[model samples]
Target: MPPSVRRSVEQRADSVGFIAVKRAANAIAEAARDSNSVRLSGAEHTAAYLLTRMPATYAASCKVLDELRGVPVASVLDIGAGGGSAALAAHEKFPLAREITLVERDPLLAEAAREWLPAAHILAGDLRRMTTFPPHDLVIAAWSLGDLPAATVARLWEAARVALVVIEPGTLRGAAFVRKVREELLAAGAHMAAPCPAAMPCPMVEPDWCYFAARVELSSMQRRIQGGDLSYQDERFSYVALVRDPVGLPRARILRRPRHHPGLIELDVCTAQGRRSERATKRRDRDAFRAARHAEWGGAV
Candidate 1:
């Protein structure tokens, strides 16, 4: 996250009282655990979703959008835009986008989105029932594909004229869904645009899933709601970006934080060849070592 945005989030967090926020956070967490639990409705649930989940979702969406930076985007379609986080992130990243559409099932959530994202064309309906989607320059499904079927997801990719980005929670289940979608899209001839070095099969095996984290400053409301005293929170997520046209292939993706030893920098990376550990020594490889020192997890090296 940028310092300016961090400061803005912090200021917003400072404005809300802690106790009420904590209660709302607890309720939201409980509700999220069970799919059969009460539906997200009413003002309190909407407020809870916004205060707790929106920032993390927005931060995750920002990371996904970063992969497509500099691409021409005149139109965007945001699927399952809970409180409009993805739409807001898209607008911030592609300010020139003239047509923005948001598809959300919940009327209350869709209504909330209108207030936050007035410029977007909000479509209130279940995505599963929709047979066709409007083609757009960019299509994003952020933390919204876990429950969707593979056919529906494929339709989403087919509707994208330029790119398709999917973001999911950083969990075992989320990784499984992302991997499944990645394989499906790859088979359909889409090119991997981010988080992967090449279009070859994923090298990571069972019990190990690919995921990344984005640091987001928690609003006072978010901090209090989550029962955390920290100024910022790390939102972990798993994502895949597929493009209609191939972009320059990245060499490899740093899988984790680089470890520095006496005069060596060790990196865990995923390449077309497979997952491997590479070492750069300051004495022998000064430039590579320097680049490794600055490399971040999930970034291409």
Candidate 2:
């Protein structure tokens, strides 16, 4: 996480000083074990969530925003904005955005959002009941779609006037949800914007899923609460960017980290045609090999 964001989270955690960090950590662990349980009810658990999960979520959201490099975003609506991490990320990415709205159901989480995101328009309502949403240039649902029904997801996509970005955990199940949502958005006439070369159809199948990882440095308080020896963590996430207007597409997206050898580079790429493994040897293709050498996991080749 960036120093600014880390400081913001730390300040919020400090405000909720009555709760013990250990209890909040334990609550977060218990909630993680059971997906169907209601977790963000009290201030302590909300604070714990800010301390433990907010940084990684913010990092992943920022990664998604980075994909929209040249696109203009003047307004943003973040659905299921727990702790307002997505809103914060959007503000950092597009500082010119005149309006940012955050919709969350839990009262405690909503309260925390008010403290963290004073500039955003916080709408306290259940997503299932939200029949109509306000218009915005960008609509984001980060780590929020898995809990929603397919109909609701489609509705949210329909509300996007410019673009829609959905993010989920990098687990297999999360990838499945992202794939399903991608299909729904495509059916709704949205165009692929990132991490995909085309909008034809997902070429991936079972035992293989599309995902990316973002690295976040853990705060001292976070390390103490989670009892971790490492000073940083990698947050794996699956995301898709859909736009109303057509944009330039990459020829192929590197799905995995490039493999380097003595004089060769291997890249696992997904293109509009299909998934394939391509090799670039220094002797055969000097330029291609140089490009592959610097390519990261999610970059276009």
Top TM-score prediction, candidate number: 2
What would the per-residue lDDT of candidate 1 be over residues 1-301, giving only the tens digit for each residue? 3344445434433454455545666777786554312356565566666667778888889987998877788899999887778888888899999899999988877886786567789888888898888999999998887878898898899889999999888877888889999999999999989889899989988888899999887765565556647999888899999999988868999888789898899999999999999999999999998998898888888
Q: Lowest summed lDDT over 10 consecutive residues: which window, candidate 2?
A: 32-41
Q: Which stretches of candidate 2 lie over 4 Å from their true place?
A: 1-5, 11-19, 33-38
Q: After superposition, how far is residue 27 of candidate 1 from its true place, in Å?
A: 3.1
Off by over 4 Å in 1: 1-21, 31-38
RMSD of 2: 2.1
For 62-126, candidate 2 gives per-residue lDDT tens digits of 98898888888999999989888898899889989979999988888777778767888989888
Worst 10 residues of 1 by lDDT: 8-17
> Number of the top candidate by lDDT?
2
RMSD of each: 3.0, 2.1
Residue pairs clashing in model 1 are: 13-219, 13-220
